[model samples]
Target: MPRTALFVEIPGVLIAAWAPDLLLPNVGIALRRLRQRNVPVIAVTDHPPVEADEFPDFTERLQRAILEVGGELAGVYAALPDKPASWRKPRPGMLLAAARELEIDLPTSWLVGTDNADAHAAAQAGLAGVVLVEGVDPPTEELGIVVATARDLCDAPRVMIPRQGGCWHDHPQR
Candidate 1:
């Protein structure tokens, strides 16, 4: 079977802002827990429009941010402003690229994000589902891919992932 992976969107899921300093409360603990289980976590992000290929220091900042929060990543992929449309959110390119690079099985993988674009992209990319960290009270109808919602990244597992395959990063412990 193709290995399942976890795609965590930056800004909202991990950090509350674009900078490396604002990691959401308890996200660091949650991310570290995932690593202890051997789940390969990947970071995927989209930056605001910029004149260059990417926002200066975005990759470096992202890495420092994750590491600072006690989390680790199997890989990192960012959709640059100057990159093709397919690489941006509301599209499947970045996720697809990460999946291909990591040999991930999209249909069994999961994405945790905070926007409608995140849900749309995960669905388009064929991921099994999405955990909307911030969304409507009853968000299921908004996107076919949104399988659950949590108050924040810290609450995801308890809210939806009660058992293996129940929600985001729903793979058996390796």
Candidate 2:
């Protein structure tokens, strides 16, 4: 079985709404379940440099929240403000970086995004598959990319687990 690493986008996927820092419904419960199952989760996000500088401890706070809920945050990688366009979801820089840091095989990994472009990017980056949260329609034709849908964040792991087997770390190959 191939190892599965979860690459999530924070603001829309994990965070409750489009507003200021509201956690989406059922996020905590879902995260706990993923953790109990030994899944690795990494937040691949894009935040303005000014926000990072002004808040300073924002990333730490996000990581702490995940820890408090029993989920292991492999790491948080944000796109540089200066290079915003290149670091956005359709681009795979942050996802690639997380795979390297987590020692996850991109070809066997899975990425869950709040939208289509994010999922498409993961597939483009060589991930085995991508999961789009409900409400976003997947492409009519497969682009050599496997796609799935989670009714919401709570359903994401449930949707991903059966699709992606055990972590590659547990296998002898790595």
Instruction: Evaluate all candidate structures by whole-model CA lDDT and list the values in order.
Output: 0.73, 0.69
Residue 74, model 1: lDDT of 88
Cα error, residue 76 of model 1, in Å, equals: 1.7
In model 2, pairs of residues that clash are 3-167, 3-168, 16-22, 16-23, 16-24
The clash number for model 2 is: 5
Index of the highest-lDDT prediction: 1
Residue-by-residue lDDT tens digits, candidate 1, 50-164: 3244456656665677777767888878776556789988899999988888888887778888777788898899887777886634444545554678887767766544223
lDDT (Cα, tens digit) per residue for candidate 2, span 61-110: 77777777766677777775655575776777778767766787777667
lDDT of 1: 0.73
Using all chains and alpha carbons, the TM-scores for the candidates as numbered come to: 0.80, 0.80
